[model samples]
Target chain A: MSGYHIAIVGATGAVGSKMMEMLEEATFPIESVTLLASKRSAGKVKNFKGMELVIEETTPDSFEGIDIALFSAGGGISKQFAPEAVKRGAVVIDNTSAYRMDLNVPLVVPEVNEEALRTHQGIIANPNCSTIQMMVALEPIRKKYGLKRIIVSTYQAVSGAGISAIKEMEDQAQHMLNKEGYEANILPCSGDQKHFPIAFNALPQIDVFSDAGYTYEEWKMMNETKKIMADETIKVAATCVRIPVVSGHSESIYFEVEDELATVFGIQQELMIAPGVVLQDDPDTQTYPTPLTAVGKKETFVGRIRKDLDEDKGFHMWVVSDNLLKGAAWNSIQIAESLHKLDLVKI
Target chain B: MSGYHIAIVGATGAVGSKMMEMLEEATFPIESVTLLASKRSAGKVKNFKGMELVIEETTPDSFEGIDIALFSAGGGISKQFAPEAVKRGAVVIDNTSAYRMDLNVPLVVPEVNEEALRTHQGIIANPNCSTIQMMVALEPIRKKYGLKRIIVSTYQAVSGAGISAIKEMEDQAQHMLNKEGYEANILPCSGDQKHFPIAFNALPQIDVFSDAGYTYEEWKMMNETKKIMADETIKVAATCVRIPVVSGHSESIYFEVEDELATVFGIQQELMIAPGVVLQDDPDTQTYPTPLTAVGKKETFVGRIRKDLDEDKGFHMWVVSDNLLKGAAWNSIQIAESLHKLDLVKI
Candidate 1:
């Protein structure tokens, strides 16, 4: 039973559970797995790969003998515990925005930027869920055609917020359908001053709006995309929105490539064979990606590729993937696998 | 009651009923009102301003003495009866996409380009539900700063399909909540070969995709925006998606203005006083518009205004309005009112 010893912080949360499932399904050669949570959830028992594991309360000393720690509790928790884990010589792969923008912490979407993990200084930040899928979809095209600009509008799922938010959306919809007025306390970013019902509506604000007007979630997509791609020259603008979806996050992207002769066919061909990309575009057959269909998948589904009628260098497509899997859990696991493959992880 | 006679085509449909309500609410100057529908719907009685009007089977002679005819049945109905209504001395303001691109037809969003009504040759076409609202928000800015490019992504409602489609969405949600599998008949587009469930899901394809890989609905937005604004030079691109909402259509628009000095505050100031525009964008108070709040509203709600960090000329905004109202019914009625103001209606 010789394998890497892994500690999963926030193991009782929605994404944390998914991370456990992904690790077990992918068979990451774990010698021992530790389930860690906050004080309230510490004594809870959860099942993983047909075995029950008791959740332990996280402390700075929790990472004493750990080889790797996966963090997904929240940005606040990640900020507080990530450095502590790193101080104990454990590599931290954080799924929060806590250290994503830090110059020292490598933001890695393994499909797109696995090479960045080699430069990681004990902590490797996982990009935002929306940015991870988009990066995987665009990386192949960028490698061949040269990326220039991107203008995207996202239809994100409520699950991106957490387990409680998903329940809130379900309860709100049920209440509205039963002719009872609904209560809202945790949507359109719970940390924001306002809470709106996302039962059957679209909220343009994802995270709290900064003084400059862009929500912090929108800012994450714009900035994280640049850092992950390592190309600040490429222009990016995003309008992140929350729709009444439970799992998959879909995006409508209009991007321009540097190649003057890039055709829609060429783009489709690239996506057809790109790693972790499933091209489901066939309008005549009524094929395209929807949130419902992409719910359990770990791949970024791209479709509806069309050349812009006015702008020669522009093209439009739809991208969708499971927000918890490819967006958070599986992505974190992929980064770990990449590190192991590159011999960067110390056990 | 010494005013012109008016006829309502497709009077039994959703947009058509809304037209009747708008007409009655506005107290349009009318000597008499006639309701016309297909042969199957004929003989049905509907109330208008406390008067029962029997729907007559639409025919070439139905508009014999009518001064104004409002059409909203379907494109086939509009294509078949628009010329007949015009030949019978009635001015037709169609809510269908039949003749929107026709050189002789003036595609109008009354609040944006009412003057285009002056050049109408017996028929005026209403733009798509998504485009009309975007136009109302962008026109004021376009007039003040000059628009160069627009990239929009739409979250259109099920009602935009018709009354039946709205019911279908409701039924799907109900069945899903009850843990029963449901069937989809009239979503994405009724004419499209396949149908997908819209319950808690977003459909990327709105109308049928054209040969060029864009949906007819998406094409309508791109082309109709240019025609409604009378500026083909202002480039446009759209990705039209149908969401499960029952009423309002929401859009996320990113546009570049010709004036490099335009600020977000200046744009908000112009929208505050612009006709048919309601500025609901106080981020501090969390006062943006949602589909539930925009339902039954006639004015276009604009908010979430912000400047792009890297592109100085670029700005982002969210627009929402009842698809059946400002997008169709109200817009058609407004066109007729404009025609009456200019003394362009003939009987």
Candidate 2:
């Protein structure tokens, strides 16, 4: 097969399994695929393009003959193995926060900053899920109107925390519906001290409290947005929240533009043509995007676009996308495709 | 009995039942309680103060001899009978939006603008459920720091749609968890042409879309805030979304103050002393308000308060409260209490 050799780290995890599906469904040509996970998940069999591949334990030497490696296990795994993959002559598309803020690694959202991959020093960081969808929805507007500021409040899904979080949400919902008590062991954040039930509830904290009273997830949105947009001067603030959603992530974004001439229609037009974006905003016809409607799709859905009643340059919109698809698996695959298209990947 | 005679309209509804609870729990003296509903529910009997009150069919004659009438029925019912109640010598505290924007009616959140009730022309409007809690949370800050602008995104509960909407959400969740198909009706807005499931999903449309791509619920928030604060120059914008939560409504509010000297601690101090507002903000301790924690509470809970990174005049906070209590029932009862204290109610 005349194609690139691909290896997916954390192949049995939520995002990892989605990555496997993306590799099978998309038209990306792969000469060989290697499934890698922790030792506990090793020997598990998954099929790809009519071949059964066995998941192997991720060792430092796993990337010796790989052209590209995708990492999404966790921050610790990515931090420990991403450098090993890079040193072994493999380009890593990391889906963790390990190398996201590192000045040496490029954080790329292909739809927004595909060219950033060219300067990657063997490691290209995938922007956070929330930031990825926001970039896809707003990059077009930023290009046309000169982005100034953003204030976002996210309605995130339980799956963003991983598969166990999804199961916890499901079990909690069932328990509550049955009028029985259920333990909340893995919601809001598994590593956090406190666990809150996400069934029919809205948790204000995601990932744990960090600097300036913002959660780490909120900081990822604020910090990763600047890194991916490569514009530190643009003002961005985020309040990350976890809702009962199982898959899709929704955001209410209020943004300001440098050009006071920007109108709702102009922004809508930009989004209508933007890559990986779908405009579903006809209020009169009762058309807009919701979490259920956006699930299982690779595109970011934008709706509820309206101009701020007071400020001419300010506008508000609701954006939704499947957190596991466009937010993770598909985004990493798109980055890999970009590398191949730009002839940056050496096989 | 030397106290005021009170009539409860829509006595079988979610807010109406909550109103009954409020009347029973509070020390407000009432000579008699008249339970009024549509003709279909008129035969039902409810207990209040250990006395059985048979619900009477709401008609023009229903308000005869009533000193104060609390209306929580649909807007159509309020528009049809509020004038009749007023003409029958009753002061109407309407929980519907029928006369909320009427120049003759005072849209009151007692904690924020109880004095506005003094000038009411026979009718006082209870603000929207989402707007009522926001007012209780922000009125203090507006007074102390001079609020200039506000942008809010709400994670509202299905009960805000009415009793039937709550049922639909519960049923849909059960169906979804069972992997069975479910029908969506009576949500987003019952009267609207379309319905979407609110089970583990976020519906952006609330109360139908109106002017400028904004829903009527959003418009109520924008318009009512200015009216209640008696300031037309204050800029307010809102995006009201319905989540699966059964009762409490949560808001993520970003606001700008005219006073650049305002800090997060300063605003927290104001909220600490503000009436009908509870401050639960200590990020270090992972203390913040959630929908589950705010359920059944009469006071609005405010937390996650922080200063904006880019603008010195800007700040953000999370506010949550039971939509049926502080948002409707308790607010209406509080208005009645204010009327009595101010000698505005005449029997």
Candidate 3:
């Protein structure tokens, strides 16, 4: 092949479609593309550029000629097919939490840890949606001032839960607005015992709760940030909340910097020129980032930067990005591009 | 003529009307009632206990027969007429931010600082809505374990702003859903120079920016928590956000208690017996307090109780309450009930 043959697992899914859409925009050399999904969704057809690609049932044979595989299916699919793809010489970039904390697999958010791509042994991991955007926004600041502790409270979009959750939000909102009743089953996590209404309401539990009372989604954020940033001593806490919005995930972040001299202006000036970050703070003009405004595009938007009123080393800022884009699909594509840029993948 | 005559300043306002409704449910002796508002709102007839009372344009003479006045008018109105009402022999329970911080005035959350009401000099100040709910939820725990520090992120409702802000949110949401544009003018504090949309989005700034880039609303939370809790050395920080919700305010609170052995169960036990607080922390059933579920409730709802993974003395909770009821009107009424109970209101 003249260029890399890429295979997209979970082709009919939200993030998979987004991956194809983002691939068209990025100038990466893709010789061919394959779409794969479960047997139930196998016959589905999706469009990439002007071509119609039919989704084939994902199997061990699905990655024979693929150089790079992007997997966004459920954890079971990734656990089953990712290693199979790796066995056939295709480097699998997983979008689930299946291998993120795996010591062997390099967890990468291209803007934060591109160098990690070089050590990947046939498989690499894209971080959790919330963690990826946060990593992109905080990486530069961490590099300059050094991070002491991070406390984040997220206002996440329903789209991060999947397409059904999005529909659930819209349908529930309409039902609630009309003073009717609708059963909420897919949200808060379909696998979880109870489902709460997300239309015009916020749910504190993002994924299944762990033994420690933190949701798995929250645990992912706490651990993944540390692994991706290559720091163990740094303390991270997250309170993940799901709001009615469909695409963007917004975070209220409070972090203490090791360097006491790091001013809000200094952080802003650095973020202004930093990669994958867009600074949108202007209190005078009432300018700040919101989920509705951050629906599309790649960069993480940050604003409402202020030094904490009590703590001299503490600073707070608002960080937001399209959860489906920079948070997931775009980040995977960026990792694929990074593999190429760093000469880590021989296509 | 027999019982204390109650007058409602800003009787046409959201909180003022809520005060009237709360008064209907609370067991308080009212011999007669007077409704007062601005000149523009004067002559507006509102029903109270099946009696239609015409709103009178507020003047010093309006307080002649008024033994107790509940002031929910804007700070400017309260600043102008509250002293006049007090001078005319009415105990003014002000809901504006004007007198809450006045050392001479009692900033009471009722549950946390009801004793402060005994120190009032005619005007007993109601703590901010967001602060009131947190105080109600935390006071029980603070009594058992003692509190060291608190960090909070709020999901505040539009009704806290005013009637116009609620209408603006509804109008803007419908317009945006219909794919039309609407101008946002009365949220994040109407007195602020600019305003932003609170429909399907989050605005980090709640009130106007004070020095150090913290909003006045944020400052109110930080300072009011200490003032109402009557502890000057306890550290408190707040990042207040406005959401599209109509009535209740939700806060994600992280606090450090003085006792290191404080278990989530112990905290929950304290809250279970606590007055004006409801503990709903069953994560298995996805039972948590959201704004929608908290509307029109007088008691503060607390849930999502968990011990912090890193800090031994730290714990996380979600606190929600109707900003109009327990936050504003109900708190004001509770204070009135307190004054009456304490024999401080002898008309």
Task: Pick the lDDT winner.
Answer: 2
Off by over 4 Å in 1: none
Give the TM-score (vs. native) of candidate 1.
0.98
Q: Give candidate 1's total backbone clashes.
A: 0
Per-residue CA lDDT of model 2 for A257-326, tens digit only, reads 9998899999999999999999999988899999999998899999999999999899999999999999
What pairs collide in candidate 1?
none
| Residues B1-347, model 2: lDDT tens digits | 48899999999999999999999876657898999999999889999978989999999999999999999998999999999999999999999999999999999998888888878889999999999999999889988999999999999998988888888888999999999999997888888999888998999988888889999989999999999899999999898888889999999999999998899989999999999999999988778999999998899999999988998898999999999999999999988888888989886
Ranking the candidates on lDDT from highest down gives 2, 1, 3
Candidate 2 residue spans exceeding 4 A from truth: none
Q: Write the per-residue lDDT of candidate 1 for residues A221-322, one digit (tens) a residue.
A: 999999999999989889999999889999999899999989999999999899999999999998999999999888999999999888999999999999
**lDDT (C-alpha) at residue B93 in model 3:** 94
Give the per-residue lDDT digits (tens) of candidate 1, residues B101-170.
9999999887888888888889888888898999999999999999999999999988888999988888
I-RMSD for candidate 1? 1.0
Better of 1 and 2 by TM-score: 2
Q: Summing lDDT over every window of 10 consecutive residues in candidate 2 chain A, give the lowest-scoring window.
A: A23-32
- Computed on C-alphas against the true complex, the DockQ of each candidate is 0.79, 0.87, 0.65
> Which portions of model 3 miss their true places by more than 4 Å?
none
Clash pairs for candidate 3: none
